[model samples]
Target: MKKIIISVLLLGLIGGASAYYYAFVYMKNRKFDMVNAEAASVDASVLVKAYQENETSANASYLDKVLLISGTVSATDQTQMGERTLTLSSEDPFSGVMVTLDSAEAAAVNVNDQVKVKGFCKGYLSDVVVTNAIIVK
Candidate 1:
């Protein structure tokens, strides 16, 4: 009985140590620095169309990946977080790609301007959301 209890305690200790290592040490050192990642360059219309046609396949290809997209700005909005969000016009009237940029940077862009943007895709919600966007051109 004592030997069984000791073995169980040893197993528990090993499991706890492994969990701590993964949850704290490993996770704390991980980075999601998408700004510098290699990205797939695409047109805004194509990206929006792909998502609208098949969301699952689109997510697999684009979600969490960095993208460089060129499109005409349809509208710009200032979010509660003070981030500037721009709606890129798509061929489909019902859908578009929403790019979030730093307010200071987005201010330099005006509605109706054609520009190239780089960002991390955050999947869709009526519109595809691309976060941490920077104007590439």
Candidate 2:
């Protein structure tokens, strides 16, 4: 009886310590910086089409991955968080590629400008949202 009780308590302690290490130490240390990360280079139209055709597959492939996309700038806005948000035109008029960048980067972009941008694909709502973006061209 005493041996069984001690063994159970030991297993519980081990499990708790493992959970704490994973949640605090292991996860906290892993970081991917979108600014300098390697990304898949694609056209804005193609990106939008993939989502339109099959959103589930598109999200699996693109979500949380860095993408370098080239397209015409449709609109730009400065968010309250001081980040610049841009809408890049897709071949389809309704769905556009939304890119988020630093205010300084957004300042240089104007509406209808042909540009290349790199950012992390953050899944699609109505638009394909990209965050932590930077102007590459």
Candidate 3:
């Protein structure tokens, strides 16, 4: 009985350690540097138009991909969590490309600013969403 209990405890400890290492060490280090990544250069209006015309085709071209988008800022807001966001204007007044800016680039932009941003496309839901974005100079 004692041997069995000891073996079970040891196995449980090993499993817990493996899970911790995979969650913290491996996954934490696996984040890609978005600034240095290869991305498709696009205009904000053009991207919105593509999604508006055909979401399926647009997803094939842009979903989960990094994009460098250029446009005039239509709005800027800070979320409750203090993350800065920018909305870039498209041809359609009702819809725009929404970018969640990285902490480093958040302080340097404003509405009407013609800026370029790089981010990963997170698909569209009324507005096209881009996350982990940084302003491109």
- Per-residue lDDT value at 88 in model 1: 99
Considering only N, C-alpha and C atoms within 3 Å, which residue pairs clash in candidate 2?
none
**What digit string (tens of lDDT, one per residue) describes model 1 on residues 65-118?**
899999999998878998998899999888899999844463388899999898
Cα lDDT of model 3 by residue, 22-121, tens digit: 9999898886788799999999999999999999999999999999999999999977888899999999999999999877674489789999999999
TM-score, prediction 3:
0.81
Better of 1 and 3 by lDDT: 3
lDDT of all the models against the reference? 0.89, 0.89, 0.93
Who wins the lDDT comparison?
A: 3
Clashes of each: 0, 0, 0
Error of 3 at 54 (Å): 0.3
Predicted model with the maximum TM-score: 3
TM-score preference between candidates 2 and 3, better one: 3
Model 1 sits at a Cα RMSD from the real structure of 4.6
**lDDT, residue 32, model 2:** 55
